[model samples]
Target: MGTTVETGPFGHLAEDLADLQLPTTDAEEWRYSRVADIDPTRFARAPVEPALESISTARATIDDLLGASTQPPSATVVVVDGSVSAAEAADPVRIDVHAVQTVQTEQASPNAFALLNERLCSAQVTVTVDAQARVVAPIVVASVVTTDGVVVAPRMRIELGANSEATLVEVHRSTGPSDSLVVPVTEVEVGRDATLRHVLIQDVSVRSDVVGSVTARVEASGTYDTWIAAIGGRYARTRVDCQLLGRGADARLVSLYAGGGDQMRDLRTFQDHLARDTTSELVFKGAVDGRAHAVYTGLIRIHPDARGANAEQSNRIMTLSDDAWAESVPNLEIENNDVRCAHASTVGPVDADQRFYLETRGVPTEVAERLIVAGFFDEVLDRCPVPGIAEAIRPTLAELMSGDRT
Candidate 1:
């Protein structure tokens, strides 16, 4: 990458890496996070190599997790240990087949993972979806770890055609009993009057740290719905930024996170109103236990031209254990006079009165806690427009709430 282009794509990334200053837990934004503990030199780069040897092996694992059958692609973008293959094209779809790879790139921020990604990421890819065409089945973007001390950086860019639509499912896993880092950045552009629905299910693991972010731009009259459910990862943070660039654009951001066993998950969402009559809403629910912690920050910004815009955001968190922790912050910046905006946040333990009521109703303590937690998330899960996702999430939710199943 040229100096100008590199600086243009990632402005602060270059400067931060050059300074090599570790981010502290003191910064308000970084208070709950610290990356210096992870020795940077201990993580070796894993390169993207040929997939001929692991093609069958990779497909088997995918089938086992997804519980479905599929045909093997003619080709793939393979990253073996922290490097990119000379024979592989950065763009996977152009190969006329399914591509698999691991990569990393510099992000435009000083956030712990983003800064780490700047210096450690070796290979990256950008996936593009053409206009007007539709992809029926779920397109799986798999990132599998090979070595224990290996770190991988993978980037995916998805573009939807003027009226095209598709479903993408991203799976991140490690091949061995090593501490792996996977940083995935996804950029999506929804066309005018188009509809895009994205479902992000994170099962990376409590031992892994997954920093995934996506920036989406919606055209006039377009609709975008995002569903994010996180149940694993030692420290997983997802940032979803959506810009309503055209009039009547709409976006719905919903997230459900369960942090257990000392794990922490942080989420930040931004909704930008650039056009008139645009609308957006954000709803997040979290459950924490076993000394786990969860952080949520949301923002809604309306520009002057975004008159008649309507926005509403709310976050509610439930603490399942005495040691668990939760924090929620929602901010709204309005520049237009003819707009409606509101935000609300709450963080606390399950009500004793409600718990006692459930216990008196012949429900065991464990079952009562599960019921309360289920009800807490059910309000948002019920809104999941996709039919099977809600039912599919019930068992996972039960596992976290009951602490019995994995």
Candidate 2:
């Protein structure tokens, strides 16, 4: 591999640990999140782990990890202990999945976790779809960290050429003692008139913590949509940035997260429109029960030169216990005229009126609250980019709601 292990801006930033050090609540981004729970220095100062030959000594199939799906995947890739262990591509002619030594450099950003991933990541996954070729089967990528006290950083890139179409599903899971950490970065590029559907599901052990981010750039007439489902982890966080850089480009982001016990679910998103006639929409919802916590912040930015851009964003979170807490912030930054933009956000408990109505109709209070929580999530679940994700998570959500309201 000709790739420079740590020669880019990331390496430089990694050396300067000033702002990248463990953040405090004084920082705006770490306000709602439990900054005290994460000890960045512990993971950052550990010895750099070498690339793994295999992530796990014992491997499990996709179905065993994530239940059966209505749409069987056409291609599959597995990354364990931070290494790409197995890869299968149904049609190698059009879809190229391989490992390379070199990667193009990226612009500098304030995302500390992203820079950390670049600085330490030894495993990289790349996918390229040939121009004008449509892949009907979906692609599945599963990543796992099965060791204790090990920090895993994985990097990935997905490229779709003009007129090509495909779907990708990313699954992240972990087993073993919860004294582990994972930070993943995925960059996506959609070419002219191409279409890409992406979904991410994170279900690590509740004792583990994960911080990840994704960035996507869409070209002229391209359509890129994404959905995320986050359920388990001690402190799980994900950030997304989607840029519409060409005319007629369209992108949508829909996400869901649920937390129970002492877990934390943190998510942030940005939709940037850089061209005229481009459109973007985002919807995110979540629930926190027991002593759990959840946070969401989203922003839509329309550049001055981006005339006729349309943007919409919505975020809501529900708290099921008195000790459970949630925070939501949705904002819009517009520099263009004659453009459409809107944002809405809310954080609260189950509607009292709705609950009262259900109780009057002979429904138990606990059951009524469960139904309301289920309904709150269905709005976004039904609009997910993929078809089978909602069904696969239904049982999990139901169990979470019915098991322990406290």
Candidate 3:
């Protein structure tokens, strides 16, 4: 049933490939997902390319992807076609680019896509912050895909030392409208008393597909905050897992996504509390237009030792067209009676009362609806830790709302 291989650098590629089995829609984790539509055999692994020669060229590429209005980052790492093309950093930050032939297959991956990513990833990039160092500017990582009918996997790890403070921005973009698959995985470790703010922006071509994963662990008295904006891709999905492993850990998760035309946006999250007095809160909001679809499923679990833990999860969706569809499911599993957990989810159209109030104040019906949608997203956008991301996302949201509103 399975083949086993020795563990080493670039070992067991053939055996791993032989045992890889793609997930199906029947699986609980894959339920309501478009996993069946994906044919991994259709795409080939990305070809190796030489790193960019000039720092100026790398900076220009980053600016082009992030937009001109974004502030200058303290450090920048650019990955193209799963390889580290360029890396630049300022003080108090260390950037390491490792060229690896293959991923260590000792541990099994969460899913087939993740396993494929592990096997095909071209390089591993790590960013480290020194202890107690407070960085004022954000560190930017730009992962770009530039080929068609090819698969690209990018792996990144961020480590924060004890009592350190930093902000990071990770973005995914395509150079052109290519029908490709991109799988990216990110790992984060927050040391004791450290604070980290992470902002993820996915704006790939609508012709491509993306499946990404993020995993983070917070230590005692540490805080981790993340904000995600998913605006592009034909079929885009992201799964985030955050664990509070030490007492007094805190986490805040916020996301905003918009889908239009025939696109599909899927998001899943898990908040795990394993220690006493830990807390976590999540808020996700999305809107669908035309025949687009959106799905969000989140779970908050508290372990028996997680006494006095408080966790909350919420997901809300708005449908702007009759043909659009949305699904929101929030769940909680608590083992300790002393812990407090609550979950809420809603899927519907614009609020009638809010629309009526706006129209009664002389705003046109169309303008009232647009305003309502804008106001609905602003609640989550306002919480974004990055400065220019929210500004750049507003135009996209506006364009989506400008479409036929039912």
Candidate 4:
């Protein structure tokens, strides 16, 4: 694929990448996270067919190793080897289901993989939720990046019509120990009075490296809720940027991430209020162990005309091991004094007092520690709008705390 420069409201990819390069140890965001260990030159582009059964079977081999339950079976579009499956699109919104490759890259801030995706991304699955329609089923989009020494760029575009409502669940999966690189980009447009709820789960294996970004536009009176969860990956970073374009728009952002055994995950979020009466809130929680590191950075901007805007952001981190590290930074750039904005963050280990209290109550130190960790994550889980998901995080957290490698 050849790269052609394009301009739009979001900005050009090449323009953004002019001075920006793929992250390295020198990069502020990559300081704690190192990527050189994964020899990028050894990666190959993934194949068309992923041998789903074979990989699924391999994953099952670990059933006895892990106590956490497997993801619930549901209607999903599994993208393997950089291509989406052609199976019928079930419970989709307004867009067609068939898998088609990329056309022209959209106008947006570009990065290292931007040019590659403009050319190599194999298929595009478009999904749109019509105006005023409320969709109940969660649209599940899963991707497996397994190519060795190759890079894959996947793009997903979602459009929500005026007054429409929908929920999207995107999952990232990896098979085996193959080295892989993936750059997935998502663009969302929320029409006037529309509400879009997005839940992104990055449950990749230990061998994959991922860099993803989501850009969203909310029109007048629209609402957007985004929840991101990342459990595993070699090197991972997720960027969420949203703009309230019309007056009276609202947004809610929540995220959870856990890193262990040399893995690293970084989250960068941006909330821009450009119109009057816009409101937004964000809450992010993270945990790190076994020399792993995590970072959470959030920015809330209120433009000059965004009077009466109310925005709040909070990030909290729990470090489980002495070798692990985590950081949180919440920033507010307010140009409108009439708006109400506040931001705060906290990063540290579990409360020893609480642990000692639990231990004094006859609980073993290990069990007590697990309980403390569980309680730390419960804050976010309890707020999960999905019924079963919140209840499911406990056991997962338990397995991780239990020191199981699975």
* Candidate number of the best lDDT: 3
**Model 1, runs deviating above 4 Å:** 1-22, 36-39, 50-61, 68-123, 175-177, 383-392, 402-406
lDDT string for model 2 (78-195, tens) is: 7775656666674531333334333443532566677667656665777777789788777888877766665677677888989899888888876554467788888889999999
The TM-scores of all predictions, comma-separated, are 0.80, 0.87, 0.90, 0.84
Supply the global lDDT for candidate 2: 0.76
Best by TM-score, which number? 3
Q: After TM-score superposition, what is the CA distance of residue 47 in candidate 4 from its true location, in Å?
A: 1.1
Candidate 4 structure quality by residue, lDDT tens digits, 44-80: 4545455767446434422222224344423345566
TM-score ranking from best candidate downward: 3, 2, 4, 1
Model 2's TM-score against the true structure: 0.87
Candidate 4, position 26, lDDT: 81
Tell me the tens digit of each residue's lDDT in model 3 across 239-349.
888989999999999999988888889999989898999999999999998889999989898999999999999999999889999999888889999988888899999
Clashes of 1: 17
Clashes of each: 17, 2, 0, 14
Q: Of models 3 and 4, which has the larger lDDT?
A: 3
Model 3 TM-score, 2 decimals: 0.90
- Candidate 1's displacement at residue 166, Å, is 2.3
Candidate 1 weakest lDDT stretch, 10 residues? 1-10
The TM-score of candidate 1 is 0.80
Candidate 1: residue 158 Cα off by (Å): 0.7
The sequence of per-residue lDDT tens digits that candidate 1 reaches over residues 303-329 is 999999999898888988888988888
